[model samples]
Target chain A: MSPSVAYGTDIDERTKAAEQSATDVLTAPDIPWNLVIWNDPVNLMSYVSFVFQSYFGYSESKAHKLMMEVHKKGRSIVAHGSKEQVEQHAVAMHGYGLWATVEKAASGNETPGKGGRQRG
Target chain B: MAKAFKYGLKGISGYLEPAERDLLRGLLDDVISMLESDVRENEDPLAALIGLDMDVKQPGDRALLRLLPNVMKDDDGGSLEFRQLTERSVRESKIGALRAAALGLDKNELVLTPDDATRWSMALNDVRLVLAERLDIRDEADAEHIHSMQDWSQAEDVESYLALVYNFTTWLQESLVQAMMAARQAKS
Candidate 1:
């Protein structure tokens, strides 16, 4: 297999930076965007979790947690980064046949790891 | 009958009958054709080389749109801009995987390398996505209705046949993913 991108490995650090930036008044360019995975009937649950684990380099349990959130809540903000970063992830998700979209973090109701901070 | 894919000492492997292999090849080909772009005489060579498609519009076909979805949630302009810059490459990569997987269907004894397994998983997922759209699987309940049509003897019409095919691919993909997870665990 090709070397998986370690995007999820540094997510906690980025999330902390995002939270710190959120506290200060920020400009438009400084605002973070989210990569949201939406639930669809066609994608198998196992396949969806696999994509999260392989593509994002997320732990199996963390990937399953996000997959369940998508299944139950209809969508989940699986990652947050600069617009360019999240958009790149969105394209990768589409390539894997997962229904994904990008949105401004403030516009969405959830943030990455908002459900629980404990790592699985 | 086909065996579910499994991970073992020699990587991932599965078995499919000749008829089942032909069915999957046809499905993969269909998705590839849907993703292939039409060449225009007036298109700029440089832009095409760089994978730019300024004239690319949002796919009107529901199935096509599902495969190549809008990137942004609410901004059409933003989504279009992003699509113009990246949609061509996305379509090309998807077509590449579909074609590779189709080529691998030539034999009944399928042994896949890690890269091949990833491509096969992607190819199977795309096939299922298109089949689901045709079957009008709008929600979990609709998927359940389709999934319930597993008896091949009951395929009396096009829809029933499609439902069966969809279910078959779903089962195949689910097993492939499970095997992939097992492989990942072994490596790490």
Candidate 2:
């Protein structure tokens, strides 16, 4: 039998298309990334607030507020910037034992995700 | 990123059921003054007195809860340092726990078998050793790490330095309310 087509698309054409798409996505200009720290079961609320205040220079009350939001909600998007900055942030956060990741900022605005909406 | 909320409703009740709040207030000042700063004697000596069924309760049962906020207040009057200290400590403590758990999850993580506990304890000790030996005072990045709730970047010794200073203070309002209940009980 000749190359069978996939149910969702023509398999041979789709495979070629998928490869092109992946490359296009990779080569796309960096849209800037965000540093997201998720709430966890191990860290103390005080500590999370502390990280924001100490590392990022957030005020005590402000840090506490952000920390509370993270505790109450599931996660908090901490910082926003270039991919390298975000990746570095994620690494630092990980080193500090926090669960962190970097992702492209949501379109339309560059606001850091402050617990309002989940980052894409 | 792990949040360990040790107490809930039951823990709350045990914390504050009697006139225990007053006794707690007494014990807290004693612990804080003794550990962090000097305590001046109160004119009414009985005012700060905190007696308890379980002597270990300090003044009552939740002295840690009462001190959380004050601990958050920066000695330098800057909240930035205060928040940083708190976050760094928790991160250090949790990382310590994680390394232990990573080797093998605790009973809660996997199943707290007798075997698991032994292994976990050993792993914890190992992590402690690594932290103690590897503290690169010269490295700003390494200096930033807090291994045992202490912020060495600020003063000195990584464990007792600020942790003890701030240990008594936390944001455990619920825990304090529970302690207050106990204080009232003791008074009654």
Candidate 3:
């Protein structure tokens, strides 16, 4: 069978190109990463908010919002940037006694499939 | 009461009476000692406490794990490697911070410089971590258990005393953080 016949006739050129583009983007090494802070029982809520403010230079309101997000939602993407940037933020957060990790941010509507492991 | 925060342009100029200063100094001193011992243990777990017949167990040591958490939670090998690469520097930084805070305690009224504020933040956090681990404080209930048993007389169990310290440090750190944020806002 020909290459087109082997696949389905329903697959159009546009759909195939879109899929290829998505794969290329996702596979690229420069995907944006998120520095996530996880809520834990040990650290105080006020301390967590303070960390967000002092370290990230976030405004008080913004810091409080992120802190509450982490508190109520279990985790929050406190920062988003290149891998190194996010990793640095994660390390800084760790130094401040916050439970933090770095993970690749899922782009667009695409679900972050497997291997979405958190890194410190 | 918690440590009273006195914010200034330089940083928090918090006043600690002689007794308060002594209390903080004592706590930070303890933390410094704990961290120093941990460093020694890390170098050679068995040799570090050979005379004391103590074993330095990694990950299993609740206080050690809390103070220097595993960066990689899912992979044991990766976590071990991460600890190997970063734990020493982390421990040193924590020790440095604690020592700096200890220096501030010499004065009856401890004034934290901007840098000192940051150091105090980190140092106090470590103190809380160690206390949390020792208290087996997994949640609010665990903390409350200690709080409910508080006695001003030095007669109650040590857990109550430790709980008082933990709560006091939490407030101190919170106030320091607030002062820092306010200072940052003022600068901008």
Candidate 4:
């Protein structure tokens, strides 16, 4: 399913630079944590994508990419933030019945999108 | 047979036969009961009221553990601390959704507002998850095996019955999510 055009926006260089600096600062002392969604046999692919789109406000392509990563790679770091932020997301993901866990970003080799802070 | 949920002028709507409604109601209630915590004797009333459950342990049952997974993958102490702070509220919200969906099943014709549809989807998903666990659906291969059990005549055993149920919920949730996506598109 295609997401609305309004939902998808290009990340410009200015935004990218700001996010890079923010990530650098956040990583220095408080290592950002990742909210990883693990793939399971039960959760519907559409439902997982919908949660990504609705809960995290990821665009359809972005959500589908993350969902496919989870399905193929066995897990995908869907979001990353402070420990508490990722923990809150973990709870919300559990509420949606998706298998989820939080980990310090350094603990895993894969880094999710740079400064992927969720919209409130 | 239940109609696949669809988004229309009246929002997301679906229809189910009485037996189907009863079946769904049973599933929703089962998940609700699984999530509901038992009252402890001489417990701290304030902590309970504030949704703290320091006594909460990692669920022993596989299905229950699936429902309320530990936050940290390797840090049990940290996970337990986070669980103490958040698990109670999570359980309450899950039970609330399960109960809401169960209450909606009282009628055969289901019309759902966005909120109702969200709760229904969550409830159906939770049902499917627990059923998957019981059916021992560990991987895609196991899921495919379960998905192949479509004929009612083949549901001669408990495992097959659960597989059928899991497939039913999976279909239902897929349709509901599609409708939700459509509704979201319409709004945007």
Best by lDDT: 1
Q: Between candidates 3 and 4, which one is better according to TM-score? A: 4
Model 2 is docked with a DockQ of: 0.02
> TM-score of A-chain in each prediction?
0.68, 0.62, 0.64, 0.73
TM-score-superior candidate, 2 or 3: 3
Pull out the clashing pairs in model 1.
none
- Give the distance in Å from residue A49's predicted Cα in candidate 1 to where it truly belongs: 0.6
Measured with C-alpha atoms, the lDDT of residue B151 in candidate 1 is: 96
What is the alpha-carbon lDDT of model 4 when measured against the actual structure?
A: 0.86
**Alpha-carbon runs more than 4 Å astray in model 2:** A1-31, A108-110, A113-120, B1-188
Best of the candidates, DockQ: 4
Model 2 C-alpha RMSD to native: 20.0
TM-score of 1: 0.88
Query: Relative to the unseen true structure, what is the C-alpha lDDT of residue A85 in candidate 1, on a scale of 0 to 100?
Result: 76
What's the best-to-worst order under DockQ? 4, 1, 3, 2
Q: Give the range where candidate 1 chain B is weakest over 10 consecutive residues by summed lDDT.
A: B33-42
lDDT of 3: 0.69
- Lowest lDDT 10-residue stretch of candidate 3 chain A: A111-120
Give lDDT per model, in order: 0.88, 0.40, 0.69, 0.86
What TM-score does prediction 3 earn? Answer: 0.74
Models ranked on TM-score: 4, 1, 3, 2
| lDDT digits (tens) for residues A8-91 of candidate 1 | 558897797778667644653374677899999889899998888887777788899999999999999898767787888888
**Per-residue lDDT for A91 in model 4?**
85
Output the number of the TM-score-best candidate: 4
